[model samples]
Target chain A: MTEKLNVFAVRTLTQKEYFAPGHRACQGCAEALAVRLVAKALGRNVIIASATGCMEVVSSPIPFTAWRVPWFHVAFENAAAVASGIESGLKVLMRKGRLPRKKIVTIALAGDGGTADIGLQALSGALERGHDFIYICTDNEAYMNTGIQRSSSTPFGASTTTSPAGKVKMGQITWKKNMPAIAAAHNIPYVATACPSYPIDLVEKVKKAASIEGPAYLHILSVCPTGWRSAPELSIKLGRLAVETGIFPLYEVEHGKYHLSIDFPRLRPIKEYIRLQGRFRHLTEEMIGQIEERVRKEYAELKEKAAKGVAR
Target chain B: MGKRVGMEVSIAAAEAVKQANVDVISAYPITPQTHVVEHLSELVANGELDAEFFCVESEHSALSVCVGSEATGARSFTCTSSQGLALMSEITYIASALRLPIVMIIANRALSAPISIWNDHSDVMSIRDCGWIQFFAENGQDVYDHVFIAYRLAEDRNVLLPAIINMDGFTLSHVIEPIEFIEQEKIDRFLPPYQPVHRLHPDRPVSMGGIALPPIFTETKKAHEVALQGSMPKILETWKAFGDMTGRYYQPVETYKAEDAETIMVIMGSFGETASAAVDLMREEGRSVGLAKIRLWRPFPFEAFKQATLHAKQLVVIDRAISIGGPGGPVASEVKAALYGEPIRPVVYNFVAGLGGRDVSPSDFIKMVDKAEIEIEEGNREGYEIYGVRE
Candidate 1:
């Protein structure tokens, strides 16, 4: 049941990039990095239906765009639903010989708020309907575009504008939504959790998901330094720390089988991941111990599930 | 002209979608509208219509799917009823704002408070300003014909906006009627292939539905308004072309014996038929009563409506939906606003009738007209009256 990471190789990217530069994303936005990798992975013959959130606003401003591919931004909660339409439309055209391309890769990209909170119903519907598209959730924990409000994906005890740390109440009181598990419950063909710090893993997962015939879900832990109250330069560091500490594991569920893609032999304490972020500044030693216990319990459960290879 | 066949209204509507050769249909079933999508699904399933049929999870996703496919230059379609349309309300606005040119058929039904499952105009009124070109179909013939008209006008490069064809729930939807079914070749010649001026294609990349900030927000809205108002000519031209081919003509306003009448009744949707019958009875009695049916709801048909009511001294406006605490019903308010500054204005009487499937027969229409005349003379026509209300 143990899994090991592949040895580091020379990082080379595809020559053709669909996501161009000059996007209005922040200096060290990990979501932007993930999108760049995803665009490269899904090189050509792709259409992206994005939701109304940071990625969409940053990529497409009023008369300018950073996308070199055909892109659409619908309402906040219907990215997956919109992509379902695109997939169906393309299929019809291809079948009728109206379109020159025999196949097109359709992807929907959304932020944590657009994926886990407001947009979850549409995502669930799209997955249940088995649309031939890949939905990528760029989880930044909070609604960063709206000035750091807490989303359902915001981890327990992380301070957001809406979940600010105060004298009586701790930061966030709820656990991060388990989106991959929810997607797994739909019994889609592919479900994976990825991190931007691991470009090779993220890109590979995107490519794999694009090749999937049925619905595929990819949850990427996109680090947001501004929302997390950490140094912008620590975006990549935080992404790596998140996966390394078992707070966010990199794994895939294909059909009904679970396989760990990036398994840590030994996990660091929860503080190793939270200490660099000011959002966790109010955590006492007792609180940190509690968080550690919770993380260990959840990691142990995920590990057991991966080992048992249970569909459910 | 094509052969006439006896078919259920819903099936005929589905046949129109088939003849249009739409590329995609995404729908979630609601009563009255279900038969339309159910038949469409069969057509797609049997390869009769080469289209993608998506049984979407909700009406929200149904219209959202249409927007997605329409942006890809596909002629997309979807149908819904009262609560279903309410569920799809948000995306309905986006479809028009994005200029997707989708054709949607709304089997008009009563909105829920008591949860009635019959016909009314509440569903259509709920989306009155969603920016889509809207039409009311009075019978099975209009439902079948308006489908083609909806597509033609909506897809015109000058129009490039979504359109809605509304038929009364269960009344026009479930009733079986003999309709002149047009051939596929004729439909092809009329509709042609939908060639979007701009669409989602990798060869020519375009960004759709971008955010409009403070500087350009009002300007964007202005552009949408101008586009809709500008679509009037194209709507007329498309109807004219269809009429030339089939001898079945349509206009923004159609009058029934209103040419030389002193009193007129204004109604939309299927109730127009009942009002026409009532007008015939009144005319036989040597009374100067007539009916003016409003087919086009958007673009207002200002000149046409004004011309239709200008000669009449008393005009009765029937509305099926209330604006709820506003002055009178939605239709009556619009009519009063339309006639406010005119030099020759009629004494308008607002009447709310046939709500939530309460049948307003021809006799009831006659009574309604009689009551409006009394109210006008008594100067009690300042507000609206709920026709047939016990109190």
Candidate 2:
């Protein structure tokens, strides 16, 4: 699927945007862009169950909705459970001859807090139940929808409202949860990590997820300029820097086989990514060195996993 | 007429759901509520009922699954009790707000503190204001019958809201009684396949459960209130239709020997039968006593309740659940509010009895009336009494 597309392959992607314009997202909100690319990949034959978060609040404000496809937003933590229901409902209806037996992908959308924090149990339940669905976790590190509070997905040393860098304490005290590893541990068919900055890679991954048989999980690192306290124009660049710095790697795990989406000959320095974001402004050189050591170790581990390329 | 079989109330309720041809059944097992979902799974497993039945991880997910399936245009059903209801109470409100028309059976039990899993109204009373159409069942038959009624009424175009059928936990749900099942062909004609007002479909796209801002929040609430209150006529119509088919009539506020009576006992749930027996025994003694059993709990049948109890000189309201400190009992408060400021209203007396499966027998009902009459004579009617208390 990747071989057919050229370097500037985003132009070859379908122009029909299932996620319409006129949404209420802030400028340079890459979460909204990630949603658009996901919508574009899945196209019209899909039903979306979105959790109550930034994208849901922005796109669906009562009488006006930016979703051109069938969409539902039930609550904050049950997007995966709702998607399970939708998948089962469509199957039973089709089997009972009440609905036409055509393929309609069921997709669940949620933000970082909604997925890694509140929605984790429900997502695990749905995946274990083996529902035919795609779960896209649009992670912006913090709970950006609700005033940038710290979430389980929030990285260490990143200042949030709840985990402020005060006189005694610095930023978030905990490491970001490895949601993709947890998802892959469920033995689901497909698990991937993508960013909106690489539109073609993200689109290909989404398409691949939609094609899979059972549960597929995509952990998208959606850059939130408002929450990160970064310049709006740096949203796309920050996403790229995140990938280049080996902070947020681009990879996929298919049937337990590890594959790196983009491999770097030499990773960029972590300072390039941290310096661009105000959330990490308080971090000293020593703190940066500590973060750099952890990132390097984790990136090496990921490279080793890819090198093995063995299905568990 | 269908066959009359002796079956446990929970099993019969599951049979009723099967007859309704529900497309989905998602529920988590709680005590007393377990039998209903267990039977449903068995039916689905045996191919007797072609429905999607699964036990979700938690009661919250159980109702969430129902909300999802129902919103996708599938007729959905679920059952729970006590803590399960409390766990899923959040989604119950969302389900009604979304107008999904899912049907649920609540095997009513006492809420925690001591964590007693027994018959009481505490579970149902906790969610009294959840915006779903609620009713109580007196026995196994009523529990079985209300399954069809709830689905029919809930799925109606004019009343696209969820409905709850509450039956006492062990007293009703676990007891075996002879239930006359309605014929499938008759149920087919009475309750047709659900046609959702709006659904998740690829061919015709629509978004549901959107965020309502301050600008239109009040209007949405008003519309929901109007829709719930407006469902009265359809509730009666559906009951009348079911009665016409089954030869068993039902009403929101059913009365027994209340005409020309000076004292009437107002009650709800399975204990209504015992209260009726007490009324019969009291009538044999030539006392002016009667019973008014309230079946429909939500959109309270104020007119019928008023008509039944207003003519009486004294009214005794039996509540199985207490309202903590504010009011003695929640039902008594509602009853008082319903008859407040009326020109010719009865003096209301409230008794909170049968807490946590302590049986309220026919004699207990008689004792309540006896105590109420004495208390009324002594002019001590400002608050309520917890009847049969040791203190």
Candidate 3:
């Protein structure tokens, strides 16, 4: 099934603007694409906590702001904590004063490195603390800003600067840490994964997450052209390939059950997804088979769980 | 007029919050601090204190609940120590930044690693720049007196900053001491019910925390700075009013025998009592030594600090914390800077002591003063130095 993105499908943005063009993001960055879509759904009167990462630094250049809404930039791992603070602060201010009483919502934005790595403990603490905030992770896999380094979210068999795919070593031997699964394990209200290519789905998930009280996690598969060694235009194409291969499934964990949101009629070969990105250029046929087998095993387990649906 | 009853300091603090007539008490129990909140909860349960008692799941929630209650125009409080304060720190900073006027009792304890439940300034020190008006009480009764004043200090329309009453964990919190309870009627006469300058009512609207751009951010910070600076005189006035009613005088920087002293030591929080006894012991030994206790850490009392140490030939600033690679404890550094342009600034030397509640003996205070004098006379002038360490 040759599923190239159809250009005829045009998605027009409304007059709503939460995140504006002044944000500091690399050209053709998928995270930027995801932010624009997510913000459009969140609407105004929204407050954001952008954790210290490439997005925060580039968008908020000192005095100037890329966000049209009220935003805060705290340390890398405490976006959730900062948002929690603002939420609570608003409650107090509103209770004793008139400010922060309107139809305001709080959201936390973090990079994959911040969410899956350094900020995990704080995130867990905030969720346990029962803070009403939405946590969004733009998972670009590698730490692209501080020079591309391997992160827990980096996929297996991907070549990072640290995990170079060499003649002797091959590529990344470890699998990506199941962050959405971990977030769901918190028993939070909602947890879902989306791809930048599917902006409507991503925005819809964000709106759903925001509408719910308590903690919610939305993981967006943001492809990095520089890190993935793919053409800028191929970022969205690679994102689609990831979903088609069942390598990065589009699903949501609600309450305690799993529901697969997307289903391909037939699985696309792993070589097609691998061949498009330079990170997977060094995979040998044997390596490819091993990856394929692992992906199949993971998919089987996910399907079994999804089939079970809310089992204790 | 008074009765000497052996009362635990935590109970003393709990009684003080009771006297302050706090409308809501929301807190999670932690070491050394549990007793205070437990007492408050018991008071609430028994109907002795007609207030909301929230047993929050975590310290962060505890503070958040207090913030919520305070915004709703209720006099709110919470108690915690060590990791609890660290957990509340993110919101702790926000509470002050938004000027919630919420008061908290922090039974100060050491931070984790070895995971000590013991007394230390580490946890309180970690949140030094959190914007809360911090105070250190030297004893159980001081804990009682300070809490009454703390509510007044924090709730002042000009101040509008959250206040933290820092007392030693277990050391003072669990220890029993004689405390003369201020009658509830008397407290009522002293503290008016919290009438906030603003409220979260639909009838009126105001922005508490909004998007602050560099151009507009300056105004937000300027407003905060003005409030902090403005709170100084209001705090003094309120303390004076409380002093007139209760016959207890309060100073941002309290002086103990610094008039004709050749040497002086600056200390803060509950450790001031131990330091005071040391100063008395040193003076008995024919040493011209004095002590300065900083009750209000936020306002810094720069002018008062400068004036109190103006006559002293040498100054020993004791820091109960370590700044690691930077300028030692945050206290001594600020003190040194506060005196930088003083016409008669004393020879300021830093001394780090009583960390993790390591005993701060009177002899150590004497030794610190003598060493500072030597550094002063020798003219090997430096901005700051430390005390009570292994040679």
Candidate 4:
């Protein structure tokens, strides 16, 4: 089933900036774009806990930081854990009449490797504890900060520094871990997947996640031109392709009920998304067929689950 | 004065945090340390204390969250034991390096391979160089008093460093003792509000825990070192203020009957009480023995240590943990280093004892001192001995 693309109701973003300029991110960085939009949605009444990744490294370089909002840079594997403390800390302050504001949003920003691999246990723990915070995983497929190493979030058939297409091996041999599904299994109030290509969709998901009472996890598919071996200017285009080709579906799960946000009834071929990226150029026809088959099967499963209505 | 009541040392530690008006307590449950957090959780739940009690999943997250909350300008506390403290070792350095004033209570337990959940100094000694100002508590009163003392020293703007209060596991944590609970009003006047100079506020943003390149890494380390070393004055000043308020004095290096004694026994943690008892027995027997207890381990109190031991001819240093194939015990090694350049110092002898929950009584301490005195008189001072070990 498909829903109408309501672009008219989605208002244009405000001029105020929280993720200020002068960050050392690569040009046309999709993750940077997502962070800007995410910050805009969160507004100023928030504290951010960022794990050691591209976003953290670029935004903060000692004595000079791009973050205008209150931000903390903890270790790589404990962004969610840190956010839990921030939320609880603020709650205690408010209850004790120490803080003037009764409430403040607590958010965590982590990279693919931080969310899917090193930080998975912390993420799981925060969600299970039902802390009032939003955990955003800006998935750039691989560890873009550490020279394009393969992470669990790296999709199958994508070549990375650790998962190179050598003489015997083609590329990455395993499928990308379903991080959103793992988050949903925590039974948190909200879990969603978004793309930075559609700024309004991404911002809307973030705002919705922030409004939820308990923990909300938002997984954003951020494109990495340098890691993906694509043109830097084509970052937005690649992000759109990831969604349009059914490679990274745009959907939200509320109270364990799945709802598609951007449903492309007639999906574009995966080749359109893979051909431009040099990381996937080493793929053979047989391997492409296998990937395609796997994508279709997963998409079918998602549709069936979404159509099943609210989980009981 | 609030009240004088007999309370479990762990519960007294929790009450001390309550008196400090801590804003957040993020802890993972571990044996011996569990009772402290349990009482804290009860206080938060019962509305007796208005604070956040986070049942963090692991010790790593417990300390990680404390770092997060403390950076946000909140008074935070946490507690852990052997494996829990070991699990939190990585973030322990981060908490200090970032200069987050989060106070933690470590109910000391032995690190395992034999897997014993008993009282020992191994856990505290394992992370000796983590850069936190560590204190050893001899009893329930010290545990209660130092909780307030640690927060005051840690939260000082000049010394924005994390602190650890170590109490012997099962021995002090499980033992009930009569303690004077200070009034909250007095604590408020003494501690004042923790006004964070640099905090994570959206209105006034400041970046913490930033990456320091090699060019500035050395400077950052120097700053941290200077800050730690410079904290000694503030530590003494804080103890003076606390002592004035409560009439219970504390010092970096405390002594008992050591003014004219030829031989002095040095110890830490709960064993300090036992060592003092042994010193009294030795004095009764006219053996000219005394006791010196190290309360402040970090900022190592080198001046105080030197001053305390200069008059003694010999020192029987008791260590509950071994350095394992390197030198002697950790405390013994630090003690030797502290005394190396001194013109007049004791012929220090190390005795590793009371490990893995093994009880070291007052009689045992007396016997160890006797052995050490005999060794020194016979000019047989060589390697350190494992006191009371079944050889």
Q: Is candidate 1 or candidate 2 better by TM-score?
A: 2
- Tens digits of per-residue lDDT for model 4, A77-129: 99999998888877766666666774578999999999999999889899999
Question: In candidate 2, which residue ranges exceed 4 Å CA deviation?
Answer: A1-8
Clash pairs (backbone) in predicted model 2: none
The local distance difference test score of each candidate is: 0.89, 0.92, 0.78, 0.89
User: What shift in Å separates residue B173 of candidate 4 from its native position after superposition?
Assistant: 0.7
Tens digits of per-residue lDDT for model 1, B1-391: 6999999999999999999999999999899899999999999889899898889888998999999998888889999999999999999999999998999999988999989989889998999999999999889999999988999889888889999998999889999999998888888899887889988877788888887778888988899999999999998998899999899999999999998999989999888878888999999999999889999999789888998988899888899887788888887888888888889788888889889889999999999888888878888857478989876
RMSD of each: 2.8, 1.7, 6.5, 2.8
Q: What is the DockQ of candidate 3?
A: 0.07
> Comparing candidate 2 with candidate 3, which one achieves the higher TM-score?
2
lDDT of 2 by residue, A215-293 (tens): 9999999999999999999999999999999999999999999999999979999999999999999998998999999
- Displacement of residue B368 (Cα, Å) in model 2 is 1.2
Candidate closer to the true structure by TM-score (higher is better), 2 or 4: 2
Tens-place lDDT per residue, model 1, A1-312, is 011223323245566668889998998899999999899877767899999999988888788888998999989999999999998887877777777766678899999899999889999999999999999999999999989999999999999999999998889999888999999999999999999899988887887888779999999999988899889999999999999888999999999788888788789887989999999999889888888888888888888888999766
TM-score of each: 0.97, 0.98, 0.76, 0.96
Q: For residues B239-355, what per-residue lDDT tens digits would candidate 3 score against the true structure?
A: 898788677778889989988887888888766888889989988889898888888888678988887888887778888777878876778888889988877778778878887
Model 1 alpha-carbon drift over 4 Å, by segment: A1-10
TM-score of chain B of each: 0.98, 0.99, 0.94, 0.98
